[model samples]
Target: MTLRSTLTTLAAATLLALLPHTAQAAEPYPDPRPITGQEIIHDPTVSRLKSGGYVAYSTGGIIGARLSEDGRHWTDAGNAFAEPPAWWYEYNDKADPWAPDLSRRDGRYWLYYSVSSWGSNHSAIGVATSRTGLPGTWTDHGKVFTSETTDTWNAIDPAIIRADGKLWMSFGSYWTGIRMVELNPKTGKAIPGAQVHHLATRPDAPYAVEGPYILKHGRHYYLFASYDACCQGVNSTYKIKVGRSTSVTGPYIDSTGKPMLEGGGDLVLEGHGRYIGTGGESVFRDRGKDVLAYHYYDAEDSGTPKLGLNTLRWTKDGWPVVL
Candidate 1:
């Protein structure tokens, strides 16, 4: 090749390397790790039990539960609560709970869940505790945080993270996107007089973002959230996006350095192949590896929502990728 042509090619390659990762064509989403049996779930939050095996609680009849002895095969395990608490009726007539988050802390299991009617800002996030982290073992702890019709942010989709020796709970949907507030570790509820902090939101109307999960990896706090329309089955546009901040709160920036408060997030996972509308994600460390647990609509199965589990691998630059 001529010297001039070689120089031109080298310059083009250098420019491409300098561009943001998003500027390049994205790789296809990898399929979820295969599993069998009762796989239907939504907004799943999974955790390893103290005794053994794993348990998942999700949005559905009284916080539906599923259990897996080996993580690959699952079975329906009934609901966390045999019946909804009387207080839940204030948020919705059906007294149904949604998006239950399961975590283990201080020798106990904490379950945070949401209750609200469709298209209304009146919502509440409640907490429960279990000794074993198993189905039908939770003891109701009442509401942790809530929102009213007068509030600008809707309170739903609770995700908890412990950072810098402090407990924080992130929650929100539709009205104004994701939000967080400090929690009193002793009581496992929002601290009195604690200021609510804004995390992420889209610039456009209706916002269309929700389901926030924060994972602390290395020196940065990564925020993962679901973006776009969800619950439409085959027609759902839900996808998982992410941003990172050195601090647990505020000014999360994507690969392009755009703030998450202004519609900035790097695409992590999206619908591909038979897996349509992949979203409502949560991350858990299983046997030293990060595992992503979410629900996806199965195109081959009449758009039925099913459990999706994939290994979360990080790139050299520290961004997460599904493997």
Candidate 2:
């Protein structure tokens, strides 16, 4: 590469960092090789452990765990939560953990995950409790939520957000739209008989929205979601979007006030270079910095989905720009 080309690339990056609304052009991020047992690591949900280090979780194929001392280079801890929990024998023929959301609350690390089956929405989201955010000592809370029928929208990809002094969960994608329900402060279970409020999507162009993560910055509540084809090798077109509302059970709308129920989204990151099908986002605020965690299939790595972490910054005018 020529020096001039390098200078051009650096200038472009600078411009992106300076601009807060539109995303910065995708560049080669920190690709720490020997990301130790991070094989096909997809559906990333990250949390900063109270005792320092970061716990990053993923689904399917071994159900792995990677610990990052500095929120970057990971030391593989092997499979943390494997499937075939005997619950699968009672339900689906196979057990696939969809997405796991990690949070520290009430002096314990609560890990909420799901179980899935192919060709059916007959699924369940489960929870596990850990005193230390490491492998071992995880107490299972089985079947947090499940589908009544195989055809109805399945409950998976759980993203728990605490708003208005209560915990809310957003779960669902195809078959039915995304909905939010309050969880009991003690057990983190949905308040009994509390009808979940519908949040986004319409009958037309449903787009199969899922992976909802909320970030409450300043006074606005931001709802970030992923839209379209996931899990399909290189043919996927998954992208992330965000909308905000004053209330947790929101009629979330885009920057233009267009309802997410109306199928409106502002794109944050998409496939670039050898990366394709970027989606499955998890957002959190840490140490005055907002972090976005998601997965992208790296063609350079033979379409293997690898975990990615990027810094998120907001505009003076209230737009979230990915750094």
Candidate 3:
């Protein structure tokens, strides 16, 4: 160790310390819980039936359905309706309905769904009721809300929430992000003349945010929505984001205090590993735990859309984490 060499070594160490340190790579996201049997699904909304087992309704086949006795092993249960209603053809020439939401209230199961053609804003959300929440038992109740090409908002993706003792439906896609309108609880229909409230959107064109689901946790209402592109299978870029507000109809703010209406949301879940394009989410309670129901494109299965479920846990600071 010559003195010159020691001095040179010290100088190099000092220079190394002065230079910026390399950032450590972030941890990869956890994969969805493995599921089996009849997992093919898209835009799935799941509910734990009062009669035991779970039923999921999604976008396809007059509102395609899947049933699970244990919430892990699912089997195809056919479609919600044997045939689409005559009015459905007004929006969708094929009479196809998409994104059915099911909830139980007052001893009856209420279902809300949307009908529309691809890339069109002329859409309608309809309501139905069933005694058992089964696929074929639902009785169509006609349109609850609608949006035309002239309207700024597109009406699809119906999500119902009872906040502040009032029923509200949050729905929208692409045209103007997410919007909400009050509903008549008795009829499970939109209240005539009720004001439409805007909840979330992006700043740029083709706003990219939709599939809004609101969950009331503690005193704050959390708004969860899918962001970015969808339906491209392996290329789909869909992911889930969330924001929270003190009011049901809000200025919901993200973790950084950015309002949801201004495109601010905290990332809750995203595609990672074999799961790609994870979105189209809904929350359901089962056996005292809040579960997140969503669909992900499976890379291992050649980008097939499949069911994904996670236990949604809340942090000490109130943010949600999917596990």
lDDT of each prediction vs. the true structure?
0.92, 0.75, 0.90
- My TM-score estimates for the predictions, one after another, are 0.93, 0.86, 0.91
Local accuracy of candidate 1 as per-residue lDDT tens digits, 212-311 = 9999999999999999989999999999999999999877999889999999999988999999998999999899999999999999999999999999
Off-target runs (Cα >4 Å) in candidate 1 are: 1-25
Better structure of 2 and 3 per lDDT:
3
Candidate 2 deviation (Cα RMSD): 4.5
Best by lDDT: 1
Best-fitting candidate, scored by TM-score = 1
lDDT of the structure predicted as candidate 2: 0.75
Cα distance off (Å), candidate 2, residue 177: 2.6
Tens-digit lDDT string for candidate 3 (1-323): 99999999999887654432111014366677777799999999999998999999999898999999999899999999998889998998899888878888889998899999889999999998999999999899899999998999999999999987899999999987999999999899999999999999999999999999999999999999999999999999999999999999998998878999898998888899889999999999989888998999999999999999999877757878777
Tens digit of per-residue lDDT, candidate 2, span 74-164? 7777666544467754445556567888888889988888777764567777788889978655777776767757435667778898887
Every model: Cα RMSD to truth: 3.8, 4.5, 7.0
The TM-score of predicted model 2 comes to 0.86
Q: Over the full model, what C-alpha lDDT does candidate 3 score relative to the true structure?
A: 0.90
> What does candidate 3 score on TM?
0.91
